[model samples]
Target: MYPFLRMVKELIKFRNAPAMRVGDIHISEHRCWPWDIDLWAELNNGRTLTLYDLGRIPLAQRAGLVSVMRKNGWGMTMAGVSVRYRRRIRTFEKIEMHSRAVCWDDKFLYLEQSMWKKNGECANHALYRSAITDASGIVAPERVLSAMGHSAQSPEPADWIKRWIEADAARPWPPMQDKR
Candidate 1:
């Protein structure tokens, strides 16, 4: 089951947080519970993605993207993501998470998130490409930002992000059909 209750708690907790502009970081902390563990007694890999929502959703609300989406009848969805997990997160251990929108292009918005242990080790990091959608199709990110009151052009993407975008472009769509 999804952690719907935990997500609601986070929403309520940040209901009045100071509004953040594009690119500002939103920080929060969370603990791993027994249900979050895998056979190795560590936080499950898939759960890490779900836990990220606890931060990402609040980040969106704080940045007013949620409001913009609601007002315009837009929906947001992840188009792609890359995550690196270097350290193990054990059950009952607390981690600090940092999340922020990095930049965007006409087609997609980018965001980054990370989790850190108390001793200052970065346990994991993820880069996400997302899109705003309506009934017709994907809505341009620039249009979404305009609706959110941010008119500035996107900051230059980092070299790694640029490389990733390039690399991903070479991957075939509707992948792996030949094997069947």
Candidate 2:
């Protein structure tokens, strides 16, 4: 189930917060509720991804992208993601989630986000590729940035992210298998 209520709360809490640049980080705190736990008694992988939305959307809001999207009738969607879970988050544990836009290319925007425990350990992290779309199709990142009142020029994406992009591009679009 979608955590719409939690997302709304995040939006309201940061409504009056200052706007941020693309390079600025957006920080938020969250707890691992009982419902968020998997059978292993830790935060479920799917839930972690969903919770990451709580950070990413607010980050977009702070960067003024959300408003621009709304005015233009554009929508955002995840194109791809790479995540690493390094530690387990127990129920009732507090986590500090940090999110920021790493950079953008011709087609998509890259974002890096992490979940840090209260003890200063990184529980998990992920790199996301997101696309902004409208009635036509996927909108170029350059156009999206321009709509957000920024220059079209984008900072260089990190080497690792670039490599990941290349690797993903090389992958087959659809899988193949034969019945045994």
Candidate 3:
């Protein structure tokens, strides 16, 4: 189930927070609740993705993207992602999540996010490719940026993210047509 209540809490909690500059990092803290645990007694892999939303949406808000999207009838959606889970997060454990936009191209925005344990260990990290969309289909990142009152020019992407994009582009789309 989506954590709607948590999202509302985040929104209200940060309502008066200062807005962040474009490409700046947004940080937030969260706990691994009992309901967030897997049978292995650690944070569930799927739930981790959902929890990332707790940070990403606020990041968007701080960037003023959410307001622009609302005014323009645009929506944001994840087009692809790569995640690494390097450490375990036990129930009741607290973590600090950091999120930022790494770069953007004509088509999509690339974001990097991570979670760190209070003890200073990195628990997980992820790279995401997201698109802004309208009724017509995917809206160009340039257009989205312009609507948000920013210049259309994006920073150069890092080599690793460039490689990941190239790799993803080479993958076959609409995969797995054959019976298992």
The segments of candidate 3 whose C-alpha lies over 4 angstroms from its true place after superposition are none
> Can you give the lDDT of residue 72 in candidate 2?
94
The C-alpha local distance difference test score for the whole of candidate 2 amounts to 0.94
- Model 2, 117-150: lDDT tens per residue? 9989999999999999999999999989988889
Q: Each candidate: what lDDT?
A: 0.95, 0.94, 0.93
TM-score of every candidate relative to the true structure: 0.98, 0.97, 0.97
Superposing all C-alpha atoms, what RMSD in Å does each candidate have to the true structure?
Answer: 0.8, 1.0, 1.0
Residue pair clashes in candidate 1: none
- Alpha-carbon runs more than 4 Å astray in model 1: 178-180
The TM-score measured for candidate 2 stands at: 0.97
Any runs in candidate 2 off by more than 4 Å, and if so which?
none
Could you tell me which 10 consecutive residues in candidate 2 have the lowest summed lDDT?
Answer: 171-180
lDDT score for candidate 1 against the true structure = 0.95
